[model samples]
Target: MTYKAVFFDIDGTLVNEEKEIPQDTIEAIAQLKESGIDVFIATGRAPYYFQHYAKPLGIDSFVSFNGSYVVYKGKVVHEHPIPEKTLELLESTALANNHPIVMQGAEAGYANYPTTRSIRSLPNRSMICVLRCPATEAATGRRRRCTKRCCIAKLTRNRCTRRPKLRSVT
Candidate 1:
């Protein structure tokens, strides 16, 4: 039997702590493509966080945010957005606990508490935008507006890379 496609996790698999892909890995991926295996990225990171890697790795398709969002050949094929009620509950919970929340979407990383140590420690954190919860989205609309999301809130349950599945807002 032969595999037609290969999926790779971004962090510590394709890239190291410094977020750099080794030359050997690049060459190996090139060789895989030469042999006709389609390479794709399957990462917990949001699409915007890892979009830059696509060009170098020759990957056009990916499963991001830990399978919560999927883009096949530059088109979003799957998604699991958090319901509006759930998000509101989270916001209130985080507020009560005084925990910061950092959200991830296809466009950018959104943060509720910008000065948290979690957001400040990152080198590329300048990209994160400080915003309130679900305010920017239209006041009344049937369509949800969000692709992916990550929350750095200090919580004790249901953690996936310390992020909540944020797919859409009211």
Candidate 2:
């Protein structure tokens, strides 16, 4: 059996723990493309972060944001944004839990904390909106700080209540 397309996860599959892509992986991808097989990336990370690696690796298609977004040949094929109500609930829960929240969007990301190396690694750091909690709202805006109650399990349970509808682009 032959596969027409191949998808690889960025973090550990294509890139190592040290964040370096092995030369063999790059060569293999090139060989696949030369042989008429399509190579793509499927990652939970925002698209911009992996863009620099895409072209060099001969990847033109992607499934990003844990499959919430999809792009093919520089064109967006699908997208899905979390509902406003759900986002609000998440923000409130995070605030109550004192957990720092980082919201990833299609083009950029938003964080409720200072810019860290991890956050800075995004393609466009300037696009990331820094949200300030009520305590620091005076200096920023109407953001709230995430407290200790912002457990991942609780947040996951809350978000699972409603699935975001996928928006297809022709």
Candidate 3:
């Protein structure tokens, strides 16, 4: 309770399993600030994801992507992305085995998979990108909590065309 800085995990600690960050959590962070304590976030979420989420709570420092990157007050303190050679090997293995893959780049990402793949495949790529961005970015966003069931539900619920039933001629 008297710690100088507190590092809260994004998933299941600050945010729900569905990646929903409750308003109460934000209030708790405010209380910490009022107590003169520095609050930080540590999560597997990418920096960009963590930023959006942590910003709401007024958090500035973060250990994101499982510590691959570190950010302090909106400035990048450190970064550690996977090597290009390793990325190539992983992509090759995935392609050879016909498994889905996502390559996280410095400024962009590449997702590779069969078009006939299932909904479960898309998020794997997004998670990879999340690991590359700052932690704050990963803890937030539509892609952060996208799962197979959630994706399917969204697809079903959000219909582009709402057409009325048509009568058939005899």
Candidate 4:
């Protein structure tokens, strides 16, 4: 009858339209945690983008990349990456259509496009790296492929804020 944990989505649930967490929300989370209720973030955002908000809010559990990955108390609890074949197809499709692709890994984010201001605006500014290779290279290990447990493909344009069609690789 009672919930033991609460999961919050980052974009609109935890943070407001301006991407800022309200004081009341912070206090509410604190109160819940103080009451021994586990608070977690369930979002499509990559893990690299969690610390800024998670740390401040004292949330240590996460279901990131739209459930493709999960972490509890700094340890990986679950992860699922897109199949290699699917990744290849997606890469080729994006290239053919000229749709920018942003790959989210357990540790960092990768993009086939050149470094733009929008990519730099990600929560953890330093974690999202611009891939040096062309779109044809895709995720070749020779060029620092995302070696994380889970990788999600995000289809978008130059501006990341634009409605990116999120696709889970797994």
**Alpha carbon deviation, residue 113, candidate 3 (Å):** 1.9
Q: Report clashes for each candidate as comma-separated counts.
A: 2, 11, 18, 1
TM-score versus the correct structure, for each prediction: 0.66, 0.64, 0.56, 0.66
Report model 1's TM-score to 2 decimal places. 0.66
lDDT of 3 by residue, 1-170 (tens): 36788889977888987788887887888888898887889876555445557767788888776777777776878887665455546645765796666443322223443243432344433322121222223345333433322211111123212111111100
Residue range 77-122, candidate 2, lDDT tens digits:
8888776566767766765786667666655555555357855666
- Please give the lDDT score at residue 21 for candidate 4: 96
Candidate with better lDDT, 1 vs 3 = 1
Encode model 4's per-residue lDDT on 1-170: one tens digit a residue. Answer: 78899999888789999889999999999999988899999988777776788888878899988887888877878877776677767766765686777766665555556366855677655433333322224544354433222223322343122212233532
Alpha-carbon deviation at 121 in model 4, angstroms: 2.7
Best by lDDT: 4
- Output the TM-score of candidate 3: 0.56
- lDDT preference between candidates 2 and 4, better one: 4
Give the per-residue Cα lDDT of candidate 2 at 112. Answer: 53
Candidate 4 weakest lDDT stretch, 10 residues: 158-167
Candidate 1: segments with Cα more than 4 A from true spot: 96-98, 116-170
